[model samples]
Target: MPKCMIDGKEVEFTAGENLVKVAKRAGVEIPVFCYHPGLSVVAQCRMCYVEVEKMPKLQTACSTMATEGMVVKTNSENVKKGRAGTMEFLLLNHPLDCPICDKAGECDLQDNSYGYGSAYMRGSEERRTYVDVNMGPVIQKNMNRCIHCTRCIRFGDEIAGIHEMVAIKRGNDIDITTIDGKTLQTEYAGNYSDICPTGSLTLKDFRFKKRAWMLKKTTTVCEGCSKGCNMEIQHEGDVIYRCVPLENLDVNRYWMCDEGRFNYQHTQDPTRIIEPKVKAEGGWKTISWEDGILGIKEEIDGQKPTFLVGSDLTQEELTHIKEYIALQHPGATIQHFGTPGLTSTQQDGALDQILRMKSKTSNLNGAEKLGIAPLMNDTIKADTVVVMSAGRAKLPKINAKRVIAVGVYLEGDASQFDMILPGLAFSEKDGTIVNHQGIEQKLKRAVLPRGKCKSLSEVLMLLTNKKARVGANP
Candidate 1:
């Protein structure tokens, strides 16, 4: 461990930890543009300048190592002046287009300039211009807004193992571009949006939708696969604006896959079922929650119950459902259903606090916690089957006299069920979902569950007399 003074406060940090990391640990955030933890340090942006005792000049805090008895001043006038100078230089090439730029609210350059630079520009000459380059299908590049941070280039070459971007030319003509005019084709390509200090790299789907400040962020886990990537879903009211990676060092670091970032549109699609429907004589009709519960109870009381658990349900829901089922029918056979062996190799190496099973669905650990194992490679036969399909179109067919489908979406598979119970979607309810690594992440209600749709716990309470309400602590 190396002890150093950051912003006049003495603190100890792990050996080899950069000054920026040490400063952040000591509650001082050094404004950075080119620094990334997972990628190689280029020290190009020069925004994280700090004054150190006995040093001739200010140093880049990101690349400087914390040493024992080192005295660093981050907020002193000298350091502030150097940062202000750097901000001014960075803005020299940047266009004053915050109003129309997609990265307006969340732009680091805009924020840093307001914090450390002059309100007015000193340059009277026309700003330099460059042609916009098509970086990739997932990323668009406007080199004019770029500060030449090289975070994107470093990320492609180091983290993603793809050298798709590079700095070309020299001096005023220094620009980031691809070789042979090829697009940046990488699986983890969406991260450039986060690394971009300005509006240089913007998401095609989220651009111009809403300002960053206008969107509410909900911390949740990615359900794309078993690699439970910690995610923050940003939305306005019921509409999801975008999905960004929440920094969890043990989980998906500061990166998430492009699929995880863009797959949220399906959650708000019109095809989702928003209300409970019962298969009555008049086809499938929307039923009240009270009537729906009673109908399920009536059916369960007369036959052996089979609970079908989906991998998508959170661990908490899995716990409550499994416990309630055991208290109601101790001998009930619970079957786990999900797209098995459907692992994708686009691993984000981010450790999700949520325990990820070999099966990627969110509820596997919850089922295991309740002393119930997921259905293995064995066929299940039951008189009454409780099928919980989070979004899948079909479930493995087991010999069952009656099928009960509980989910938020309507598909052809639910049609086979005698009773269809609509459940809350990800945005509709408040719950905790564990990621692949067993990190329990909480998701608050972003939108009201449409119609009379209820959560899995609510539906279980109705099916049986067992108390099904879960506490917030879990």
Candidate 2:
């Protein structure tokens, strides 16, 4: 351990820890452009300069290690002046096009300028400009707004292990661009949008769509696949703005697949089933929640009933449904269904391996929690079957007299059921889902379910003999 004084306050930190890390630990934020916790220390920005005792000049706090008895002044007049000057120099070549930029509201440069930089520009020379390069289909690059942080270039090489991007030239002419004008094609390429401090890098899909401040952010786990990557969903008035990685070290670790990031739009798609329906002589007819449950119970009472559980439902919903079935029919058989596989990643390791798990949602954990035993292949005989949610691969082939489909999506060849119970999507319901790592997270109701659609919990309460409690936290 090494003891150091920051802004006249005594503090102790790990011996080999950088001064910037120690300062952040002590509730001090050093303005930085190129510094990242996972990457190697470059200390190129010089924005984190701090005044130190016995030092001839200000030092880069990001790379400088604190020594015993070292006195560091992070908020000193000289240090603040140095940071303001450095920010000005960095902004000299910037385009100052925040009005039209996608990163305007949440940009680090916009925040740092308000904290440290002068209001007016000092230089009279024409701003340096560069042609915007076509990086890839997913990412748009605006070179003129770049601050030479090299975070993007480092991210491609270090985290993604793809050396597709690099810095070209030297001195005042230094710029980051890809060789042979190649596009950035990597599985983890989307992460650069978060790492980039300015509007230099932006997602092609989310460009000019919505301002960051206008969107409501909800922290939820990604259900695109079984990896259960931690994520934050940004939306406004039923429209999803964007999906970003929520850093959970035990889970996704600040990274989520591009598929998981953009797949949330399906939940709000127009084709999604929004109400409860029952199979009639004409076709599927919209019915009330009570009517739907009564129809299901009538079919179950008529013959042997089978229950098909989808992997997309949360653990709590799964547990409650299984419990309801057990209480109704003590020996009823339940079948499991999994969603089809999506695009897999090329990376290896526990983190990546976990991300590639084929069962996309946390429903497996839910089934386990409820102690609902899955029916084996030998136990396929049944007269009535109740299907829950989507994903029917785990379900056994049965010759049931009556089939009940309960889900938001009309999926698979098992749609010839007598009763169809329309369920709400994850975004249309309020419940908690447990990720693969056993971390519990809540999903809020983003929009009202269209038509006669109802949540699984609501339908279960109606069907079960036990009265469901209101405002229960799972």
True-structure RMSD, every candidate: 4.5, 4.3
* Span of ten consecutive residues with least summed lDDT in model 1: 343-352
Candidate 2 structure quality by residue, lDDT tens digits, 1-474: 668888887888987899888888878888888998767789998889999999989999999998999999998899988999998899888887999999989999999988999998899889877876788877899988899999988888877778888888887677788877888887776788988999988998899889988999877777666567777888888678788988877777778878777777666666655556766776667776666666676666534467777666777678777777767766777755553322112211143532445555545555555555544452355666777863323444557677677653553333466667667666566676655555676666665665566667766776764443322222
Cα error, residue 143 of model 1, in Å, equals 2.0
lDDT of 1 by residue, 1-474 (tens): 669998789899988999999999899999998888877888988899999899999999999999999999999999999999999899988898999999998889889998999987798778889887677678878888988988888888776778888889988888888876788788788898888778999888788888888998887767665566778888887678888888878867888878667767766767566666777886778876666667777777745587777766776777787787667778777766665443221222333232233454554544455555556544567778877756631366667778777654453434667778777666666677655455666656666665556677766766765433322211
lDDT of 1 at 284: 79
- Name the regions of candidate 1 deviating beyond 4 angstroms: 279-283, 341-358, 377-383, 392-394, 397-401, 407-414, 432-435, 438-440, 465-474
The estimated TM-scores of all candidates read 0.86, 0.86
lDDT of 2: 0.73
Q: What are the lDDT figures for the candidates, one per model?
A: 0.74, 0.73
- Pairs of residues at least 3 apart in sequence or in different chains that clash in candidate 2: 225-360, 226-360, 274-453, 275-452, 275-453, 276-452, 276-453, 383-401
Q: Candidate 2, which segments miss by more than 4 Å at Cα?
A: 279-284, 339-356, 373-382, 390-401, 407-418, 430-434, 438-452, 465-474
